[model samples]
Structure formats: C-alpha cells, structure tokens
Target: MRKIRNSEELLGQGDIASRRIVLEIADRTLDRLDSYRRIRSIMRMEGSVLHIGTRSWDLSKKRNVYLLGAGKACNHMAMAVDHVLGDRLTRGVAIVKISEETDRLNKTEVFVGGHPLPNEEGLCASKKMIEIVDHAGPDDLFIAVISGGSSALMSCPIDGISLQDEIDTTDILLKSGAGIVEVNAVRRHISALNGGMLAKRIQAVGAELIGFGISDAVGSPATGDIAVPYAAYKSTPIGPDPTTLDDARATIVNFDVADRLPKSVVDYLMNAGPDKETPKAFLDNTYFLLNTLPDSCIYAKEACEEMGIPAIIVTSFLEGESRDAGTFFASMAREIQSYGNPVKPPCVMLSSGEVTTQILDNSSIKGHGGPGQEMTVSFAITAAKTKGACLLSIDSEGTDGTTKVAGGITDSSSLKAAAGKGVSLYQSLREHSCFEALSAIGSTIFTGNTGTNLCDLNILFVPAIEGGR
Candidate 1:
C-alpha cells in the first residue's frame, strides 16, 4: 500500500523531481518498518505451542493467554498477535492513538486512546487491563506488545493523582521545551501502568510475560537480531524502567515546571520514598527488541541506496527546537549544494528523533501544527535560497500534532507558492499555524497509522547545482 496518500498532488508542484525521490524513499522505508508484518513473520502457532522470536510458549500448559498492548503503533502490533493466537487467546485489550477500519481482530478490544495527553477512554482501558492482570494466576501467560506513546495512551495515575493531573502534567511538560526523556521521567514516576508498573503487576500475580516492543527513545541504537531475546528492554508499561524518582524530581526543577504542575503530583513525587519508586528491572519476563529510532534513518538510507542515490544518515539523535532545526537543515542544504561539505549533491540526508515545539501561552496559538510541520515551514523560508533543495518532515506514525496529516514537504519554490496563495509562511510560523499554511500550498503529507513510531523521519533531498558544483 502507498504510505504517502497525497503523492500525486505533492508531485504536481514545487521541485517535483526532489519530491518524487523523497516520497519514494519515505514510502519504502515506512513499509520496511511495519510492525504488523514484522510480528507476523516471527510469530506463529503450531498445534498447542506459540512461537515468538526464539522462544516458544506451551499454551496447552497454561491456563489462559492474554494480550495487553498500548502505543501509537499498538494497532498493528497487537493485531499481529491477536491474529496468530486466534481461539487460543483468552482475551486481548489494546489502546492506540488512532483506530482505523482496516484493523481486524477476533478477541482483542481496541480503545482509541489520546496521545500527547491522556483521556478517559485510555484511563478506562488501563483499569480493565489491571483487572485482568490482577485476576491472573501463575498458570496464565501474557503477551505484551508495547511501543512509544504508551505513557499517554495507557494512563493510570498513582494514588492521590487524578486523571486531570496527569493530563495537565503532560500538557505542561510537552510545552516546557523539556526533552522526551525528561518528560517521561516525570510521567513514569507518577503513573500506575507506565515505567514497568504493568510488568510489576503481572509479576505480583505470578503470571508469565513475554513482551514484543519497539523502542522509540531518541538516540537508541539500531536494533540487532529481532529473533533474539532482548535483555536490556526498559520503560513503557510492559518493561522495567530506567527513570528514577530522583530523575523525576530533577526534571521538574530543570524545566522549572514545578510551580505550574498540579500540587498533588508535586507532593507525591517530592515525598514518595524508595517503596514508591518504579521497578528498575524485570528479570523473569522475556522481551524482544524490534525497531529503534536509529532504524528509521538506517531504513531510509537503504531506501535511497536502492534507488541509486547516495544517502547520508546525518544523525538519528536529532532534537532541540523544531523551527530552529529546520533552519539548520536548510543551511546544510545550501552548503551541500554550493560547497559539497556533507557528501556532495544528488544525496539524501536522513535523520530521525523527537523534536519539540514550545508553547508557553495557549492564547498565542492560532491554528494547528506539530514539530514536523513547523520544521518544514521554517525550512521553506530559508530553502528558497538553494534551488531544488527539498525537505520532507513527518512524525513517522502518520499524524504530526493537531493535524490529521503526517507532516509537510517543502522546497525552494514553497516560499513563492505560499506568497502567491496569500498564505504567509512567516505569519504561520509566528502564530504556530504551519498546517493551514502548508495545506494552503498543497504541501502537507498524509499517511494514517504508518505502523511505526520512531518520532520524526526527516529527509532532505539536495540535488546537484545546474552545472558542476
């Protein structure tokens, strides 16, 4: 299936050659990262045995097999497991950021959970999952498929903290300019499900847990051998957490969000002792690492190579302010086109990581947009200097923030196009309305539930100058 839904429209305008190359590479890379296909390839059933990666579970020996999942990509991950287990699966519950009609399941109950923030549906689903785990005995087995965004999608706050508190905390931290690691540190410490609390719950009930996870943490190294059991798996609701109470406290102070956050949450984290800390390790559970943030860049590089285009994986650890990053990428494009500093022209620069947008005052906001949209808009302003320099920035899982589109694609002509359409890209960036601006110029990219969540996937295509560099 085509991942980029508006490919034809995108190709009809602005640096068509560069847009075509970027879209093709992105589509192919997204296909390669589909968790549903990856899970199905490694998991199967043979009579009474369940085979997942290098391990096999004897379902006949177990009393019940339950599937529990939550994440942006949980739809695909959980569907793969639900399809394989079929009748053997006692029950399944999956919380996803978005639920589509294409999803097929027999026993699993799907919940459309909120991402970037927790919602009532996610809270209800979390309670149900807790009930299932708490009822489980030593004879039961659990298969957990977890990915990024599980923190918000599987929201269950600890004692004294209301669901509103969690939501407010998330909203505050996200706009505070703190990195995801910092945000998750505070979030995981206060949550009942995230930061390995679900695994801890399963452990308390003496249930066997085998987890299939995709680590979307920025700077995470590329995954090796998906078939081998990964021992270092951490974070999410299904695995042990590396974040500590100290880390949580440190984040609040570092980001200076202590005064703004809910007082109940502040008191809990401040006074909670060693007993309240999240589980740091799960020695008994089995985990398999699927894909990581670095894998996105690696896959994109491979896609470019397949098309005979030289690609440079500039960095998979891209972070910082979104608009600023776009400006930097545009500057790099200029260098590559003019001086050929970073591998010369006719090359693709691939990068993946979580970039954030800071919004201190909600009243200043005008329209909808995310970090990826902001980045491309910012790039368009400066990319006007470099001819044929095209850039594509998408959230990778399809939705880029408030907009339904994945992200935006822009090139040298984008600035002119926006000016002609009476869409002020500068005003859009100032008002944080990149989506409206990009949409007005026919530059927005759309691909729903891409089956992978690796933060941001940025591809910059800098074609060689008209003549020799």
Candidate 2:
C-alpha cells in the first residue's frame, strides 16, 4: 500500500475531478465483469469428452454424464460448460437469484432464487439438484458449481431440517462475527447439502463429482470453494457490530444437534486428514484451482494504471467489521493524501474484499445502505476533511446489499447531503444510513447485476491538485 501527501489549496474544479474518479471506479468495476476469464476457467476443448479435473477412474471405461450447478455463478458456469462441450451434458439445473430472469441454457434450466437469505423457492430447486446428481451411475460425471452465495442461495436442508433453521444459524454466525470458516463449519453440520454433503450425495448416486467453484470467499478453493472455499481458514469473517439478525438462529430444528457430516467434509474443514482415495465411482475425477481473488485484483489494478494513476492492490481480502475496517481504510487514504509515502501524488489504492454488516436492529429498518457504499462514504468523511483524496467503493456484483445501490463515492462535498438535510454524516453512519446521504446527492452507483462476483472493491485516489471547488 502506497501513501500520497496532500496540501490543500482552493482548486475551483476539484468537484469535477472527484466526479471523474468516482465514475471511473464504477465503470472499471463493471467492465471487469467480462465472462471470458470465467468461461476459460471452466472451458475445455471441443469434442474432448474426457473430464476436466484429474480423472479418479481409469480412462479405459466410458461413463455417463450428468451435470448439476448451485450458486450465483453456477448457471453461468453451466452455460460455459455447454459451450465447451455441447450436446454432451445429459441434464442439469442451476440456481441464480437475479440472472434467472434471462439465463437461457439449452440443456440447463435456470431457477430464480433469493440471496444472503434462502427462501422456499431455492430450497425446492436444491432438492431437485440433489436428485440430478443422485441418479448418476457409478460411471456418470457430476460437476458442482459452488460460488460466492451458494451456502444460502442453494439451501436444500436435510430431511429433518427446515429452511428457517438454516437461515437462523446464518443469522447467529454472522452476528457472532464468525469468519466464513466457522460459519460454514457450523453450516456443514446443519445442512445435508453442504460441507461435502453434496459430495456424499454424489457418492450415493454413484456419480464421479467434479466441482467447478466460483469462489467468492477470500482464499479460493483452499476454503473448499474455488468460489466457496471449504479448505482454508486465512479468512477473517466480516464482523458486523452487535446486531438483531441474531434472531435468525431461533428457528433451528432440534435434530441438528448431532448429525454425522461426511467424514471427508469434516476432515477437509479441519484442514486435516487426507482426501478420500477415489471410491471406485470417483476413481476418475478430481479437483482444480480455476480462479481466485488475485486474478480480479490484478485486472482492476491494470485498469486503474491505464487511467494514468499509480495503483497498488492494497489487499485481496480486507475482512473485518465495517466500522473498524472503514476507519482503517480512512486512515490509509489520509496517509496517501497527506504523506505521499506508500502511494504517490496521483494514485488509486485499489482494494477487493468482503465486509459484513450485522443486524443492527431488525425492529428499525434495512438501513437503506450496503456496507460497501457505506465504507466509501465513511472513508471520505474520515479523510481529514482535506481537499485532495477521493474514495469510491462498489460491490463488483452491482448489488451491494439489501439496498440495490451498488456503492457510493466520497469527496469534500459528501458531507453536503447530510448538512443539506439537516442530518449529520456521523448520525447517518450511526444509523447505518449512508443511502440517505449518498442517494440524495446522486453519487450512489447502480448497475443492475454485473454478473461477476469477485467480492467488493474500494479505491482511494490521491490528487495532483489538493483544492477543488
């Protein structure tokens, strides 16, 4: 992370410059939503009927093919699979909350579902997904698309569990500030569909499982997800302060107390025990690291450089509570503008990572703001009130949270909205109400689902001119 120095002077055009920085940030974030990198990761040669990951089986025997996908990126992954090897896919189904409105796959059916919270709709689809993979013959192939929001969006609870229980546990884990590992650790035990629950399902179906993960978690497949991570713990949970969402746990079904999760899943989560020797069915399949956070960070950084600004990828995963992380990022931007040490005069300290906002008060409201947008505005307010630096943050996916405002921008004028409304910026943050401030001024960025989930991005732009009108 580089720092830049700031010496305030009255620059009449400062506002325009700030606006450019903000728009550029939004455009660049959306531009990277290209599907090529993803398609390439899941793509293969035409006519190559052979499996993608290492084959656990001897190549001599031919196998039936059955495909299944579950997650925000699953359907898209399914589309790419069809492109790579069309007509080969026997049958498949996918779950995507938003994209299902238009996702059209020749062989795969797209089911619309909810996110951050699973609904009856998603649970129902997940059941059929299990059946698709379950019927795979010992010689059949199963490709599971595990991505960022899969845990919640693709919830197919076990026989004894209810969707409400899954949601409740999520609430408890999130409010507890538990990292994705602990959260998922607990989730693995609660659901019959996660923590290798699906793998176990595949085994029973006698299918060879090939997981294609669009890991939304920080550590990629190491956490057991290319996009979900069931293998690594370098993850720092998004610690939202004390919240009311804790109530979500009150619904867990009783039998969840003791369930024997797939031993392989448990061992993998513990980061111990060797992988299962390929059961005769899977003797022909294995896993692969198709993508990770670093890939998207590099892409964003290059775009910033092209804009003629110095760029440093601060961190691939800046995980922590929103307020604390916001404060830390605020200080970093101030250092860049006032000191010019880690980053130079005209630079954008770009960042990509996850942040969680706990249930502050369910009794109140959804707060009209997402943590990503709040962070951008929060950093701007914390930036020494000087005239040089500008901060803009956006969820790469286009939808930041309960509110659809992808993200927001901050500059000297950010405080104006609240002041105009006779509400202080500090008060808004106290209430988690950045939307009231950012939206009033038209600085909040919005682009319906960018279709890419590399997590969120924050950019701090240091300036050549410290003062701007």
Candidate 3:
C-alpha cells in the first residue's frame, strides 16, 4: 500500500474506502483465475473436477485430455494443462492472434492466428483444430479453452466469403463501438468455430467436450452466449475515424486463399442456420469466468487506499472502444482535479474491463500501442493542467498487444517526456503510439504474467494540490 496522505476519516469514508472495496472484490475475483494453476495442481491421480478454489476445478482422470485454447491466456492454460496431464495430454492445439503470441506451449502445440480480424494464419489454424477435433474418440476428452480474443484467433469462416471479408466486417464492427457480445454476434454468423459451432463439430466427432472459459466481458455466462453474434447484429452507431489501413494490413494475409471448406463448419452455418441456435449451449462441460475485470478493479482500488490516498471505485467494470473510453476517462480525471464531484483530492479512481483497439493498416507507417497503457497516456496528455494527476492502466495478463509492458502510465513526466523528445503529446496520441511513447520514457508498467487474467485495470491518482484545486 502506498499512502500518499494522512486521514483516517478520508481513508474510511472517502475515496480510499471506495477504492479499497473495489480492489478487494477484484482480488477475490482474481482468485478464481487460478483455474489454470488448479489444472496444474491436480494430478491425473486426483478425482474428476477437483476443486482448487472457488470456480477453479480440474479433472485428473480425463481419459485423454485435449487442449483447445484461444485468447491471451491460451498459452498459460495450455501450459497448466500440460503441467498436470503431461503424458495424458494426447494432443493439443491453441491459437493466439497475430503478434499476440507470448509463451510457447509447454507440452502442447501453439499457433498464432488473427484477431480484431482474421487472416490466412487464422484459417490454417482453424483447419488444424478441426483435424484435431475430428480425431477425438468417445472416451477421449476435449478441453476447449476460450478467452477474450478467441473470435479472431479461432476463426473458420463460411464458404462464400474469404478471410478478408471477415476482416472487413470486423473492422466495421470495431469502428462502430459495438460491445463484445454484439460484435461476436455478427462474428458468429460467418465464423465456423464461433457460438457452439466448435462444440457441435466436436460432438459430431463423438468426443466428450469440456470447455474452460475466461470472461473478459462484464457478465460471465456459461459461454458468452450473448457474445457470439451480438456485435454484428447490433453494431454501434459509432462511425469510423480517419485511421490508416496499413497497420491492420501489416499482420493480415488472406484476401483470397483457396476454395477449400470444412463441410462441418459450412453445413453448420447453413443447416444449423444463423438464427437457429443459441451461442453458448455448444459445450456440455463448460467453466466460464476464471477471472474478470471487476476483480482487478477492486484489488487495485484497495491497494490505492492503503497508500493513504483518497480513492473511489466509480465502476467495477468498464468496457467500450479503446480510444473513446480513453477520452472519456480523461474527462473524468479532469473533473476530479477541478471540481471534485465524484472523488476528492489525494485520491485514485479505479476501474476494469476489456477494451478493443482498431488495428490500423500500415506499410510505411510504424507505431505501437495497446488498449490499457494507451488509455492512460492519452488521458494524461488530455489532462487539464492537473500537474499531480497520475493514471495507470494495465492488462492483467502481463503482455499488452505484442509487447512486454502491460500498458501505459501518465503524469507530469509524460508532458516532460514528450516535450524533451521534441514531440507534442497530441502527436504521440494521434500516432497511436502511446505504448512506445511511455516505454521510451520508462513509464510503462511491466508485470510479466501474474498467472491470472482479470480483464484490464485502470488506476488514477490525484495528489494533494496546493489548494486542493
């Protein structure tokens, strides 16, 4: 705990208490995320569905454990699965979005695919997964691991459209500011592996399927049922910004590949019909939500309060488009500095949620940034002369995008750093290079992998000003 001031009343009544409560809840939520660790904790000798903690369950006698992972924690989940089921893990395959691949699977094979959009790699990976699923027998166990970035990473689209079409649709939805549920709704339509599509395929193969899910969305249902086709169906009114297409193109490939198609995914999309099925009812053995954003929000809030600063948790979960959310947070921070409406001086405002960044296409252009840190940096630059105001945002899983740093942090030094480099803060922000801007100034927070995934956390602090602003 980093106490920045002195006042028990403020500690108990004001922002500190609010922040502490939020962080406490966040921490408790985080405890559930040890599910991966629990999988590792339970040896094959342990009973079926052995409980390690609340919501953390494992099965030792899962005849032939098959690993199917997609998300930020996919590799971690695979590692944990391999650690426990070593020889028992007869086969494994997981996909990470392009450039999002962090760790190599311990005993499992890992594949880097696509995200925010699908690409050639994603298609190939999907084919490989289908092959693996096709091989599962009745007694063989299929552990389907899913997380936030699964849609793009585990994509296997319908027959007529190319991966590029999927990518274009994704771009439209992302720019529209549609929520994950809504985005995934349309995504599930053309995607062969979305909704319960993958599970249905496994069922077709006669494999006993068990799904392990980690929710980045606010409410974690059985399997993000509402998320499958929500975005495409209910695209947000948010219009597009003038962003370069080069960045997005940099990691994608598959304007046109082949005329090949998996009969299962294609038939499922058509025969099962888009509107004919519910999204999440795909896997019978399902465990949703190992950790979530609210959990991280509470934990960070508490830690802020223990430091003696005033803190308030305005929202337990925060979600939406990355840039828009960042700008909104900047306004809230400014308010705390000037008027002190929601929270007073010497305090921190904390929140958590999954944020999506519109991956721009780039050829000659070059930049780097992620939702978390970019939000913080952008907020700091937008600060209305609140000299001591500091904001920190981080992705709980350690890596933010393709970097080692979790995200960005901002304060007076940010302005100084920008000025020193002879660059305007606005320019860095406009370039969408907040990650590098902060990293160059040595302001990015790095916490490799906390062995937990709790969405994202945002911590904002306002030190006592000369006259309380």
Candidate 1 lDDT over residue span 119-142, tens digit each: 999999999999999999999999
Can you list the residue pairs that collide in candidate 1? none
Please give the CA lDDT of all the candidate structures.
Answer: 0.92, 0.58, 0.57
- Residue range 365-454, candidate 3, lDDT tens digits: 257777886676677666646655666677766567556666756664467656776756566566767776766665665555445556
What is the TM-score of each predicted model, taking all chains together? Answer: 0.99, 0.77, 0.72
lDDT of 2: 0.58
TM accuracy, model 2: 0.77
Evaluated at residue 282, the lDDT of candidate 1 is: 88
In terms of lDDT, which candidate is stronger, 2 or 3? 2
Better of 1 and 3 by TM-score: 1
The alpha-carbon lDDT assigned to residue 274 of candidate 1 equals 98
Q: In lDDT terms, which candidate is top?
A: 1
List the lowest-lDDT window of 10 residues for candidate 1.
Answer: 460-469
Off by over 4 Å in 3: 1-35, 38-44, 47-63, 97-106, 219-283, 305-310, 320-324, 327-331, 334-340, 355-366, 398-405, 446-454
After superposition, which runs of candidate 1 have C-alpha atoms over 4 Å from their true positions? none
- Local error of candidate 2 at residue 297 (angstroms): 2.3
